[model samples]
Target: MIKIVEVESNKDLKSFIDFPHELYKSDPNYVPALYMSEKHLLTKHPFHHHSEMSLFLAYKNGKIAGRIAAILNVNYNTFHKDSVGFFGFFESTNDFNVAEKLFEVAEKWLKAKKAVKIIGPVNPSTNESCGYLVEGKNEPPVVMMPYNQPYYHDLFLKMGFHKNTDLLAYLIDVGSFQDKSVKMLDLLSQRLSKRGIIVRKVNLKYFKKEIAECMTVYNEAWDKNLGFVPMTDEEFEQMANDAKMILDPDFCLVAEYEGKAIGFTLCIPDINQIQIKMKKGRLFPFGIFKLLLGRKKIKKLRVLALGVKEEYRRVGIEAVLYGTLLKNAREKGIVEAEASWILEENQMMNRALENLNGHMYKRYRIVEKAIL
Candidate 1:
């Protein structure tokens, strides 16, 4: 027999966070999320200011069999003008009944909140990690991306979730990319310079100001993407603060024209290389030392965010950002990089990545089902 329980106590929540570790113990590619970070995102993040969520766990024979989060994102609804709820942080056993019961509880919770439809795998929002791995399960996920058992897709489909859209992740070899545009980097930079545009490493000293401008570009650039809703000021800043910890200025580049920030790209070291070694994603009892020192051993990078303001699009600024990151990654001895979670419909950016020989190695899907 299976029982579904709402996560109410801190103990239950810990188990909720830790369940995946046990679930994927034998899966070599599973990278456990940092326990503390997951806790903060669940309990204290500013996302809670505009959304409500409840975590549920499915137990069989008194052992955790699965878990899910049912979310009512007020901000998303207000922006999209739809009564859509979201489900995320989902993990489960291969048991169909367990998965069904978990979704049933999530649907019930969202129905109470008047969410007419349920959509996701977005831990809580599009601003954070979302989607389930439907392709490329052979490798571990880069930092801040989702990875799941191959059965996850089947579970959702069997539960009546249909495809909403897919997110793409491309892998680039830092040491030897096609680099068809490598020769054009200089020409692109010069042309932009003629227009009073300059590409430079972000100024950590002026982080607050720089990040604010980047957020402006971010909101405008991604405004048209499917399911995108502009992140509130507080949400962007809170996320920036966390990124600041691991940011290397060289990997965070910005393009400005006449001192107006218009385009930027953020690539961070793949700390998952370090986190994977940390037992249970804990950063204590020597894990901290490994994290700090192991960073130098990190040879992979994830192009977490890249965007150009609408007016700046098609002006070679995008190529310049990639070129800059490529050069920096090589200098740092980075061997691999991934430009990820691009919408499948984003032809221009997808083509640009493909031009540089970025192979689409991973695909993530976000699905939906009517609440009824």
Candidate 2:
């Protein structure tokens, strides 16, 4: 018999967080998330201040068979004006019965909360890692991206979920990519300079102040995106703190006009190469050394985010940021990078990436079901 149990105690929560590590143990491409980070996110992260989430685990014959989190993102509904709840942090074995039972319980919980529709695999929200690997099943995921077994897609389909949208991941061969943007970077910089807008690396020295400035640009730049909800101050700060551990100022840039931050782009080393070697994703005893020593050896990056204020659009800031980031990555001996989770409908940015010879290599989907 399959049983679904709400994760109410510390032990159950541990099981919920650790289930994926066990489920993907035999998979070569699996990269385990850090245990401590997962704990904080589920237990005490700032997201909990404004949203509600309940975790559930599926047990079969006294062993964990699957796990999921039913979330009601009040902020998301308030901003988007939709009655949609979310199911996230999902993991399961190959058994269809187990997957079905897990989703059934999660949907029941959301239905009781009066949610009319359910959408996700959003590790709680779109501002965080979400989606399922639909196309890129052969390779390991990049930093801050999601990955899962091929069977998970089939499982979602069988459970009545349908694709809401596909997020695109583009691979750029930086070493071989030759674009006019790079060639004209100097001219672009000069034009921006004449307008008193300058692009430069993020000031890690004033990290807190820099983050605060960038937050303004970030919230404004992405406010109009589908499924976007402006992150509260606490949420953005928590993310910045987590990112600082892996941040390289060289790969993060800011665009300033008259000393006011107007835009920013952030890329981080694809540290999954190091994390994949971590057994169980523990950071103590030996994992810390691997992370610290392995960073410089990482040869790939992910263009995690890039945003410019609406007024600054069409001013070549985007091209300048991408050009400078590529030049720096090449100088650092980085051969390849992935700019991912780009919305399929974002034609301008998509075209810009293609212009730089970026190949759309992987696709992920956010699935949804009408529960009402």
lDDT of each: 0.90, 0.91
Best by lDDT: 2
Candidate 1 residues lying further than 4 Å off, grouped into runs, are: 178-180
Cα lDDT, model 2, residue 210: 94
Taking the tens digit of each residue's C-alpha lDDT, what string does model 2 give over 173-259? 999988877889999999999999999999889999998999999899998776899889899999888888889898999999999
Q: Which pairs of residues clash in candidate 1, taking residues 3 or more apart in a chain or in different chains?
A: none
Where model 2 places Cα greater than 4 Å from the true spot, the runs are: none
Single out the weakest 10-residue window by summed lDDT for candidate 2.
130-139
lDDT of 1 by residue, 1-372 (tens): 899999999999999999999998988888989999999999999999888999999999999999999999998889989898999999999989999999999999999999999999998888899999888748888999998888888888899999999999999998987484566788989999999999999999999999899999989988988678888888889988888999999999999999989988988899998888777888888888988999899999999999999887888888889988898888889999999879999998899889888899999999999999
**How many clashing residue pairs, candidate 2?**
0
User: Against the true structure, what is each candidate's TM-score?
Assistant: 0.98, 0.98
